[model samples]
Target: MFQTSSALIRNVHSQVADRVGTSIVRGDIGVGETLPSEMQICQMMDVSRTVVREAIRTLTGKGLVESRPKSGTRVRPPQQWNQLDPDVLRWRLETSDMDSYLAKLFQLRCAVEPAAAALAAISAGQDDLTLIRTAYEGMAAAKVNEKFVAADIAFHQAIYFATRNEFFWPIAQMFDVTLRQSFTIAARGSHRARALVEHNAVLEAIATRNAEGAREATNVLLKNSADDLVRIRGREFASRPKA
Candidate 1:
């Protein structure tokens, strides 16, 4: 009976997370809206308070909601969200936060990745360099152009691995997916040839152990990504259906 109850509790937690996350993403529970009280949620979902509490904790970790002593749980403002959390990132992508989110993502990259590349150039050992090179070569040899884009992503991932720092790796992994999507969209935009050139420039700098060059190359790569977003946004807004 204990085991059965535990399994039932787990199922309840998962269901609540899905429904709550969906509600938050769908704007049904807008930022700053108070979530249903524990008792209210328990009655609504027909679960015990323990299950509801656990689910709220899960959402809090993902930056979807927050709990205060007297105020109870409220949907967090965007500023308080764990933007680095993979689930949060996935939610943003699903909610089409791409335009606003991508800009900040580039801002974040500008602050981190170029410096990481420079560190890799100076400190990366044989395996580290090999990882970087392998990803670059994959980009170059990809039969499908889209696969080439994935290779480019792998190259940056290797650079993060070379940093040998735990704090940075997860953010690196999270953003890398969005970065790849952004790249594919941007690489198809106005400066395809130049974008490829920028990618090759980054690879050459890493291969040659030129730290300064690697940093600059990454900066150029991210700048182009931001530029491409501007173009993409313009086209999207132009085509958005009128209310």
Candidate 2:
């Protein structure tokens, strides 16, 4: 039936959007390149014009592309893209030509998380302490199941919450997820043990009620993260992505 309903064709749009997104994110479609026309998309994906329209809508929301009456669709510059959206962040990180974005992520982590650790040391009460300790235990126990990465992230998030500031929470989760996912894909677990020791230092500082110590410990931890980024990306950036 020639129905106007979109539900039946929604998956087509989603698949179309994802394929284009992968291209953009992976730099198959470099910045400022005008995307193929709707008819071209129809040929490429074997979908109706309606599906192309909806797929473009999805890309627009992601800050990945823009459309004009004359220009059709153009890929936006990285500066114009959304960084806070997790998918956008992941796409940018995965497709980035330079390590600049990765460096920035570590820089932000270094700037904010250490201060949060200091705050957590001063602000946490018994309940907060329990949460923090549990997070720590999760990390320690992670080696048994090789889930240390998630446990490590939980430990940091708990510490962020213990600071009595809600804002640091998202940053904590975002950086943690991005970094852990990258490590999982990139074979970069080389520095995991160093991070664990650094984490322990932060927890011990909190247990001792030493705010500055907590700050320093977290600073060292983030520094380790930054160092790993530098080392890994240096090798990855040494060669250009295959044409």
- Cα TM-score per model: 0.76, 0.72
List the candidate 1 regions with Cα displacement exceeding 4 Å: 1-12, 25-27, 30-32, 42-51, 68-71, 190-193, 231-243
- The candidate maximizing TM-score is 1
> Candidate 2 regions off by >4 Å?
1-11, 97-104, 122-128, 163-166, 182-197, 204-210, 225-243
Q: What lDDT does candidate 2 reach at residue 164?
A: 80
Clashing pairs in 2: none
Cα lDDT for residue 135, candidate 2:
77
Per-residue lDDT of candidate 2, residues 1-243 (tens digit): 011221224467877876787678777788999999999988877899999999999889989899999878999996787666666665665656445555555567777888998999998878888877887777767654347766666777788888888777777667564767544433355766666677789998987889999999887877666556557666643233233
The whole-model lDDT of each prediction reads 0.74, 0.73
lDDT for model 1, please: 0.74
| Span of ten consecutive residues with least summed lDDT in model 2 | 1-10
Model 1 agreement with the true structure over 131-181: per-residue lDDT tens digits: 887887786677676887778778778888887777768866885546766
